[model samples]
Target: MLALDFINIGNGDCILIREMEGTRQKFALMVDFGHDCLVRDDHPGELDPRSQRIYAGDFLRELGVTHLDVALATHFHRDHIGGLGRVLDAVTIDRFYTTYLPPENAPELDPFHPDNNLPKAARSALLCLQIFTEALQSHPGRIKQFELVPGTETISLQLTPDLKMDILCGEPALYRRQKEIYDAAFNGERNGYELVRWAKSMNVCSLRQRLYYHGKEIVLGGDAYAHVWETVNLTPCDILKVPHHASFDSTS
Candidate 1:
C-alpha cells in the first residue's frame, strides 16, 4: 500500500509518504516540516503555535514511524524549516536531503562567516547554515546518509514491483546567474546601499520536486516563485502542492 498525508504544519509544509511492504516492513519519507507564527499572523483563528508543533510530532509517533528513510529540507527559510530541528531531535532519520551543505572549514564557534562584507540578509543565511551544520555534527550516527541535491537532480526509491517514487526538478540556472550579477555589483561597490534588497531576492532559489507514484504524479513546488519557475522545465502533473502555500506571488 502507498499513502501520502499532507500534514497540517501551519503555513509551511510537512508531507509524509508511506510505503508498506507485505505485513512487516514499511518505509517513510518526510518533506519539510516547518511552522512559523508570522505566516499565520493574518489568520488569528488558526491553531496555536505550540499546539501546531505538538500535533505534528504526535502524528508521526502515532504512525509508528520510529525512523525515516528520507527527510528533505527544501530551503533554509524559517517558515520552511522552523520546527524541523525539533522533529529531527525526536525521530531517527536514515537519509537527509538538502540544497546546502556545511563548508569543510565551517567554524566550530558562531562567528561572522561567508564574507562579512556581504549584507545582513546574506549574513543571516550563513548563520542558519552554520546552525544546521552544528546539528549534524552533534548527531554523527543519526543520519546514515546525506545527499545535497540541486534543481536538476533526482532521487529514486523503489517501493514495490509497481509503486515507485521519483524526486525530480530542473537546474537552478537563473538563480546562479542572478547571484553572479549581484556579486559583481556588490564587489564594484556600485549598489552597496541596496545590499539587503539584492540579498533578500535570493529567497526564490527554493528547490522544487516531482513525485511519481504508480501512474500518477504530484509536484512538490517548495517555495519556488514565479520568476524561478520561468527558468525551469515543469511538466503537467495529476496533483500539485501549491507553491509557497499558494501565495499570490508564487505562481502565475
Candidate 2:
C-alpha cells in the first residue's frame, strides 16, 4: 500500500510518502518539512491559534519512523524548508535533495553579515539554506548523500518496484537567468535590491514531481507558478497538490 500524509503545518508543506507491506513500512520519503515557527515556542505570533500545527519530526517519531529513504526540499522558501533542522535532529536521512545550492563563498548567504541587505523573504530563504547546510554538516554520517535536482531535464526514478517518480522542472534557461542575477549581487556587481525584487516574483524554478503508484498518478507542485507549467507536458492526475498555495497567480 502507498500512503501519503499531508501534514498540517499551517501555511507550509510537509508531506510524508510511505510504501507499506502489510503493517510494516518498506520505504519512506518526505517532501518539504514546513517552517520552524510551527515547532518553536518563541514565535507564538507566527503560529495561528486556530490551526493545529505539528512538527514533522515529532509526528514521524510517533509513527515509529527511524529513517527516511529520501527528503526533498522543492525550493528555498522558508515555508518549504524551515523545519528541516528539526527533522534532521529526529530521524536519519539517506539522500537529501534541493533545487538550488547556495554558494559557500557568498557573503550575502550569511544572514547576519554586515554587508547583507537582502529583503526579509530572501533573507529568510538564505537563513533556511544556511541552517539546513549546517545541519547536514553536523551529521555527516547520517545523511549519506546530498544533491541538487538537475533543472535542465526531466529525470525519472523508481522508488520501489511498484512506485515511480518523475521530476519535472522549469527550463534551465530560466534558472540560469536568475542565477546570473544572484551571482551579480553576490559579487557586488548589482545591488541587493535587484536580487530581492527577482526573488519575490520567481517561482518558476521550483520542482514539480509526479508519483505513479497502483495505476494512479499524483502530482505534487511545489511553489511552481503558471509559467513553469507551460513548459511541462501535463496530464490527468488522480490528485494534484495545487501550486503556490492555490493563489490567483498559480493557475492560468
> What is the TM-score of each predicted model, taking all chains together?
0.72, 0.85
Candidate 2 local lDDT, 102-218, one digit each (tens): 566545346656566556765654565566566555655777777777678887889899999988878687667666765654555535576566667557777888999999999
Query: On residues 15-133, what C-alpha lDDT tens digit does candidate 1 reach at each position?
Result: 88777776543778788776634346346675544763443455677766678888888776656666565566667888888765654444553325434466566555444444565
**Best lDDT among the predictions, by candidate number:** 2
TM-score of 1: 0.72
lDDT of 1: 0.64
How close to the true structure is residue 62 of candidate 2, measured as C-alpha lDDT? 80
Give candidate 1 misplaced runs (Cα > 4 Å): 21-25, 36-56, 108-124, 150-160, 170-202, 230-233
Q: lDDT of all the models against the reference?
A: 0.64, 0.76
Compute the lDDT for candidate 2. 0.76
Summing lDDT over every window of 10 consecutive residues in candidate 2, give the lowest-scoring window: 39-48
Which consecutive 10 residues in model 1 have the weakest lDDT in total? 184-193
